[model samples]
Target: MIKALIIDDEPLARDIIKSYLKDNIDLKVLAECSNGFEGVKAINDLKPDLVFLDIQMPKINGFEMLEMIDEPPHIIFSTAFDNFALKAFEANAADYLLKPYSKERFLEALEKATQKINSNAPIATQKIIKDHQESVEILDRIVVRFGNKIHIIGLETIRYIQAQDDYVDIYTHEGKYLKQITMKYLEAHLPTDKFVRTHRSFIVNIEFIDKIEVYDKESYVLHLKEGQKISVSRSGYSRLKEVLSF
Candidate 1:
């Protein structure tokens, strides 16, 4: 079901929109806002998929409200004015329903909005997941024991790793530190294509790699293409060749 938020200045207008939404089996009116300020706040907090937005209001207008939110929802402009039709479409609005439009017209606009929502759902879900994962501060930094005192190391600074028995030694542009985690478990969170395990004990950052150092074997030694010398196993080398189309 598509969660919807309604924003209109008039109470009767709100009632009319609510009645129309009642017939839409897929729509649920999650919240109601009388003005654009409240609408912006509600949208940011609730993150609804569909918004029934009125163009003209007391404070901020519909267009301005869309500008304020970090991630705007599928907007269906509910307005009395038809002059803004060209501008609304230019702004990539999902759909628009003119005031006093019949149920048939509203259904048409609603269906159009639904199709837009469905088409973009996958991309939007990915963004949400990425944002959630990146924003999580749980493992953003790690504490390293430097002689007697502990040092804080940023996770983003890590460039590579080599497994040493039960502990993994981390290599970064800054320096190296030992962390207690298996290579298999750590690979799950990192981008696999970007970071590859060349040996049973090592995982290197591909971006920092300088060049592939070919020795006795023809296998592509991940020279991090940068300056860092990281080895690539025969199996890992084959996978990288296919991935890079080499």
Candidate 2:
């Protein structure tokens, strides 16, 4: 049987989804969540195979919530917004069901999700997050969950980003925090004028730069406040020079 989770802020919407799933004997509704924070906890605890997710929720939206999870379930997005449909599909969502959709449409989406789940296909969550980042408006803050606590890191507070396999480490005045995201995604969304990729694995906030020093003929290093240093590749150094005009 396919274990399912419903994550929608509206009580009516959650009930509607539950009603639609009643006919599908192969799927079982395991939990219902009103907001993204609750959804995250439910997903982590329940480990459901499929999720009916709503985009706009309190505290953090659907996309931000997904970023917190290392492995997200097969997601069928139900949202009133149409602008995110193309990006959602590109991110490999199991399906996208616009709000006020008919039962027939919901069945169709369910069927699609069921087929993928039965075949044991991996959900393209990372790709989906990256695609969503590129399509959406510039984010002013990043929402992350550390244990049971949710933290919102303002963009201005970020000092640098370092790549860590499938994740990235966000550094600030307070400390470093891990986020399951990619360099390409960060580069696409972050403001170009303020942050620059100074190496294959490092993107630094130019606002915190104290100086740029020569490491050798082909290499350079960035000096920041508190005596912190970051290596700068030849290409990265060139890009930094072009952006900083120095």
Candidate 3:
């Protein structure tokens, strides 16, 4: 079972989250706290595997309490507000439940957290997820139209993306496609450590890159390990190199 804690200033919010977890066989609602101070104590003592945190509270804030613990459990921000999407992701938060959230949304967050915990890959991905979450301007895994209906495409699958007129064309190892969102907005939402701009219109996934080739005298090009080539401008190439540590 996934041990869990709920730390929120509002009693109703905490109770609601606990009630949502009632039918979840995989999660154990270890404890609940009404303030950040008590939360710090409960979390330290229980060392729960997960926490549903609220960003605002009296005394210490969620972010401040987060800094107090070592190896903090996976966190899911639970509150009524939705404006903190970017900051919440930048912190590598597991998930967020807006106020008056449904049982389904809470279940979705629980499943997402469980997947990360059970994956065979090293725990480093969790750290990366957290770090990148803190910086994401837009939330990842948005719903999009595939053909007739909507499908969820995780932003992480995109190996490289370029803007096409008003649309952004996304490329992945599996394939490439178009989306309605502007590249400007995508740049803000993508994790800094995962993706970098290599050209004015191009963003490349660092993990998919094979090598960087210096071009004539003007710029460089990244040959993604996937065998796709993307041009990199002077400043953009430098920024890529710095971000990817190449």
Candidate 2, residues 93-195, lDDT tens digits: the string is 4478889999999999888889888998777766776677777766678887766877789889999999999889999888888887789878877888888
Give lDDT for model 1.
0.67
Candidate order (TM-score): 2, 3, 1
On lDDT, the candidate that comes out on top is 2
RMSD vs true structure, all candidates: 14.4, 2.8, 15.6
Query: Which residue pairs overlap in candidate 2's backbone?
Result: none
Q: Please tell me which model should have the higher TM-score, number 2 or number 3.
A: 2
User: Compared with the true structure, what per-residue lDDT tens digits does model 3 show for residues 67-86?
Assistant: 44556777777655545443
Native-structure RMSD, model 2 = 2.8
**Better-scoring candidate (lDDT), 1 or 2:** 2
TM-score for all models, in order of appearance: 0.47, 0.83, 0.48
Q: Report how far residue 13 has shifted in candidate 2, in Å.
A: 1.9
lDDT of 1 by residue, 1-246 (tens): 889999998999999888877767888889999987688678878889988888787644565455445567777777787454435353443356777889889888888778878787532322322332333323434444444333455556677888889878888776788765568755655666666677676777666656666754755556654366666778777656665567
